[model samples]
Target: MDISAEKLKQLRLERGLSQDLLAKQSGLSLRTIQRLEQAGGGSPESLLALSASLNVSPQALRHSSVPTISHWSFAQRSVQLSALLLLLALLLALVSLASHGQFSIYLDLVSLLFLLLFVPGVTLVAAGPMGLIMSIINLSLLWQHATGSLAERRFLQQLYQLQYRLCYGSALVLSLLGLVSVFYHSPHLSTASLQGALGVLCLGWLYAACAAELLLRPVLFKLNVSIQAEQHTLAN
Candidate 1:
């Protein structure tokens, strides 16, 4: 917010320190420290790093410039807020597309797109496609998610993330099999091959879904993980 803080932010960014990395080293939450940089008020620990590592003063860090998002930025919360907005945009876009569209061959493309959006792709796998009404409900739930606190939001995020991943995964597998089926020769189509492909695909989707749910057990409450979040217990 201030000139000095802006400069400090710029310097921090130039050093290539992530908010998480900085927080890990400085004993603070990534969010809180990020808020400081945005507010042009980094922690004393951050200041120490800046002064010692960057040869700047705490006063200078405060009055330097706006603490930016990266090693080059320390000026404004550009990197931090931009990342937040980026994820928000990506999630909203996915939700929007999934909510009010037909599951055509195009959706396979969308699923592939979703896979590319996240790292270590193909996390969630869903077999049943959501109908129009279900899509509305899902989008509505996602929009309402914005009003909650961090923990609440994290849960919703986990839910949607897993949901999309599953859908994408299912779509991916189905698309591949569909490709395989179309590739070779099949004038009338054999019962055995069809059954085998269909069976294997179903089992794969089911297994992926269970595994994703189990892996993200904390964010996703299966059988109500008994998390004392807010004031009530949650059920997945």
Candidate 2:
């Protein structure tokens, strides 16, 4: 296997362990550790042993040997863009049907403002500033991935997973809050109040599903494919 000598040495040093100590802990000979650290290749068993001793995954100890494409071809760009547009069109069609052909209901400023504010606001509050910032940075990395950028699979995976969890979590919170509001006013609940509560539930669910399906799922699938391909390449 192709191990990363620098990463191995760095991991060992970060844990404040000497080469001999790492070798002893991993149950490998000191010479084997020295050779692996001096060079970059090792058997999978050696890689696994080192990873276990270092408290890091085997993948973390390996290097990205595949060179990433700096730019995508025109056809690749067109296909990606077309898929995005088609998904948008489908979403619009579904929304129109759900609204009984009144697609303009979705264009109402109040609902739009509520959606624009609620999801991100809740995510920010829930994840805190640094977490939100990292998620945003990872989101940008995901955009780069779409442009034939094959680096940072780890960050891209984190971006989608974080957003996916936070989005659904926020939606559920919104729905529960709305339900609480309705229940609190049940004694004097009017038609308008009922409608408002239902709207909140529906909008929260709709926004979460839209965000997940349109953005998170595709990036997650792409990341999975990239990781699998990387593993296959490394194995070969």
Candidate 3:
């Protein structure tokens, strides 16, 4: 009876037991469970103990199937698009700063302040808890990306989708607010301040549009591929 590691891990999960709890239940050391789960080799005695603890026949844990990687069609497109947009934005910001001299510094500082205060609040209000969770997941995926270990295609697809949703949602809310501000402001305010507010609003909308079209739409388009795959599987 040779059980594969994947099968053993799946059985353990089906029993709703953590590795530590399964270890305790089977009278096996935690390290033993971990090793078995990772390497798929254990003595007959250990196998019997785990089987007994999981209430399964030892044969059920054997002969695990190989894991399949998802084929994410949008991953490369999303990465390339985001990189291009980021590069362009950086170049434009730098050029504008250089052209404006000291005044650009003041504008940049003010823009940063506005962004810091507005982006998070609007994202939170619009996306709520789901957005927060997705943002955390995105951050995790980004870390994986940075480390060159983001191998899960499904996860990458999800990260791109969530990022687009966040960007589009924030952009829509901010654009609406800007429109309202334009109409409701008191006549006493200086034209320069009004122009500044409009500039900030336009900047936010521009960023959102670029993100949605360049970085997000490609990911959205790839979603259909996943749907078709599922349908094909079902048809078979």
Candidate 4:
């Protein structure tokens, strides 16, 4: 069975299977798989195993050319950016909760509503069941709060806060999973360095998101104030 390094790599990538996953499926050692993909030489047994695991003929694997990496499309970039933003917002809210021991329930509600209504609502949309459950809980809480009982209001506030945390946590986890899936299928990165690089990418996205928000907050506040002033003047 003749195979070239480029051909093996291309075939593996075409299947969108990670080296570790391919190794697991083929019952081959990870190192052996990696070596064969990088160096092009493998035993007949290894070649047959890989071809079977890849769902390709051994001859096809031997003849396939290296595939060219394509630039990320607009939709892909938009999804990545949305996921990054969600991650950043979640991290910031989490930090606030940890440092302050409490957070604004109204703010949390507004943020959750924003996430559910806009800004990559895919995860929140997929979480429709959870949202419905939370809505029922919220209605019950609102009824209690409307009775003018301090204890009920406090309890409802706490529940709302908890719901906020849960929703944000769920969204963050879903976003991270999507990102991992994208990266796992990417052809540009080597399998060995992919995990470490993914970790760094996560950190970098979080940092950039936080930094951008911080830098823009003042300008955003001024813009809001100006808009409010103009609206008041028009009303007069």
Best candidate (score: TM-score): 2
**In model 2, which regions exceed 4 Å deviation?**
1-86, 90-104, 107-131, 137-151
For this target, which candidate reaches the highest lDDT against the unseen true structure? 2
How do the residues 3-25 of candidate 1 rate in per-residue lDDT, one tens digit apiece?
24466457768878776766676
State each candidate's clash count.
41, 0, 0, 0
Better of 1 and 2 by lDDT: 2
For candidate 4, write residues 85-140 as lDDT tens digits: 76687769878886786543213342344444442243235446564454345453
lDDT (CA) for every model shown? 0.46, 0.70, 0.62, 0.53
User: In candidate 2, where is summed lDDT lowest over 10 consecutive residues?
Assistant: 67-76
Stretches > 4 Å off in candidate 1: 1-119, 122-184, 217-219, 222-228, 231-236
Please give the RMSD of candidate 1 to the true structure: 16.9
Model 4: CA > 4 A from native = 63-236
Worst 10 residues of 1 by lDDT: 227-236
The collision pairs in model 3 are none
Off by over 4 Å in 3: 1-89, 92-96, 99-131, 139-169, 175-186, 189-196, 210-231
Q: Tens digit of lDDT per residue, candidate 2, span 118-184?
A: 6567567766776666556555533555334445566556656867876677677777877887889
lDDT of 3 by residue, 79-177 (tens): 656756776976787787788784353333433444444545655675676664554455443213222222444544555565666666666676687
Root-mean-square deviation per candidate: 16.9, 9.8, 11.9, 27.2
Q: Rank the models by TM-score, top first.
A: 2, 3, 1, 4
